[model samples]
Target: MELAAGNLSEGNASGPKPPAPEPRPLYGIDVENFITLVLFGLIFAFGVLGNSLVITVLARSKPGKPRSTTNLFILNLSIADLAYLLFCIPFQATVYALPTWVLGAFICRFTHYFFTVSMLVSIFTLAAMSVDRYVAIVHLRRSSSLRVSRNTLLGLGFIWALSIAMASPVAYHYSLFHLEVSNQTFCWEQWPNQGHKKAYVVCTFVFGYLLPLLLICFCYAKEIRDDQKSFYSFMPNGQSLRGCVPFIRCHTMIKNCSIIQFLNNHKVN
Candidate 1:
């Protein structure tokens, strides 16, 4: 009877149990999403208005007039900024607000592609602007032929084409994934692979931040050097124009007069 009870107890303990936990909760959506929507909306509005003004100013100004390369850069930067604000930001805001990509699979793919392309183009254009400034100030003589308007346009076109190519993978991989949670349906990226996320972050930092910062630093350094040389060469007759002002004259006269009075007082003593 004891042996029989032991067998029964062992059987009860080994009875079928719950299965292991399955993959769940691929993404999170919450109040922060609402805040993101508001912030993105404001950014979109301001970017659109500012870029539109830049475009209008660039278009109304005459072309082929040997304008500053900086102006051309501003025009192209405005175009890229406008594209991001108008084409990308609204779609992103919608996605964040809905918390599920209600937009179809095609839109999901294309929207991601468009956002990436705009981002790349914007940064590359800024880099080009830095290079233009560097050439203009560091090698002013050589810059005359190199900084033509047509060349700037061509460079912008190339930047756009390269950006599109870089962003093509986004169109290829993105898809909507549906999940079940307590009888509710949730949609998110089909596969949030760690490797892909890491790659994206690294690529963004390299192209978006590091490279552009280096270019900006180079441009500013060249500008400072050129300005220093120009200023030294233009100084008048080994005397600083800044130091030869009426203020300095008055101070010098007061010092000389005080010295003369002190000398007279000493002689009287």
Candidate 2:
């Protein structure tokens, strides 16, 4: 009697007839993509505008004007920054928006190669400039001969050569990563041997970070010891370590920031 009563009360009484509701796939704004786009866009825009202005100012000089070694380095630095801004940021933004690497392999290799090279060149040039500034203040008399020898241009050429050597590996190793689950692609480096990746990363760290910091310190220490007091040294404590500390701290901060930005964007693991 109870079983008959139960069957009568329920709509489906053949078996366990009520089915679980299937979950609906979410369709909404992806916060990660949105944030990435916003940040990348601002960086791209500002980099282009600022670097372009720097390049232009350095490139166009008065008819009788001669550029200083610092100006030359500043010019090179601007060029590198400009190239990085043009090559990496836009394409990176492209991939973030797209589902895959639709532009194909040639660009996949060259874009990253150029970007890496430019970043290296920028960091190197900045370090070179710090050294040049040290020379100017400490050895102003000798700098006249260095200026005549066109050492700045020569140094710039050397920096570019070294940068290319450091960045060339990207051409061979970087490619699109196809994520099976999401059916999406990412630009990444896949090293054939893990040792190669480790070596490359270590090299980048030492050359890009450690060496630059050391150079900045050496330059500033030389500057402090020159004993060439200037009008700017108004305060007795003005020429102290606190004043010169920024040369080490700030310059390293810039180098570390640049290298970190490149490595972060590269997604190098």
Candidate 3:
């Protein structure tokens, strides 16, 4: 009895033991990250599936058909998007989920480099497609001379080379850095100075955004103007919908192409 009382007293003296803490989640989760993850997942699924289908269809195109230049441009675009979706999306999505860069220096640099390269490839390919369309529609006779498999392939090679070269600076500029306050590491660009950073931004803006925008806009605008003029001249004024049908049919192709190019450029930017 005495020992039992002493044990009880000892237990009371020690006070109630604290409850074990609930296990922490493997990763931090919040509304913002949750939404981002969901969005990335959807994009990954749809983008991968769509791009894969396009590539497969294009690859299996009727043998000996000599795929059109537009098809070639589209194939390159799909390839670029596939590369972007495959390589960049996974790493990029991590930025929202994690607070630090855990992948190390090489992946950091490569991801950034390839991100820019893929984007430029897609954008440039869209620009090339616009030019091809302009040539095919506006200068029909010349298109026969200008649009050939060899030239399309050469253009694709140039786009890839230019993208790789232009994006090379990113690989050199990006590196892993430690944050003393957070005790975390981050992948970021380490420019030599503010001026260099500004210059890079300006250059990227001009080459990646402005030039492509100008080229696409110019090609489409000219094509539309020329088509409108041709349509107006072909159809008598005050004619029936039958007369309007031809213009509408012609404009529909241009409109669809414009929308597609604009959406692609928007995505790249």
lDDT of each: 0.63, 0.72, 0.73
Task: Compose the digit string of candidate 3's lDDT tens values, residues 1-269.
Answer: 99999999998999988899865544576666778899989989988997799789877766676776756776787788788789888997888888788888888888878877876777777778778767866886787888988999999999999989987877998889898998999887777676766666668667876788799889879877878544323212333324334533443343344334433332321
Candidate 2 accuracy as lDDT: 0.72
Among the numbered candidates, top lDDT falls to: 3
User: Backbone collision count in every prediction?
Assistant: 0, 0, 0
User: TM-score: which is higher, 1 or 2?
Assistant: 2
The residue-by-residue lDDT of candidate 1 on 123-196, one tens digit each, is 67667866876776677788778888789988888998988887675677667666555342232333347577
Worst 10 residues of 1 by lDDT: 260-269
Cα shift from native, residue 94, model 2 (Å): 2.1
Which residue pairs overlap in candidate 3's backbone? none
- Model 1: number of clashes? 0
Model 1: residue 100 alpha-carbon error in angstroms: 2.4
TM-score of each: 0.65, 0.76, 0.74
lDDT per residue as tens, model 2, 7-62: 88774656576689755423333567767888989988887897788789779877
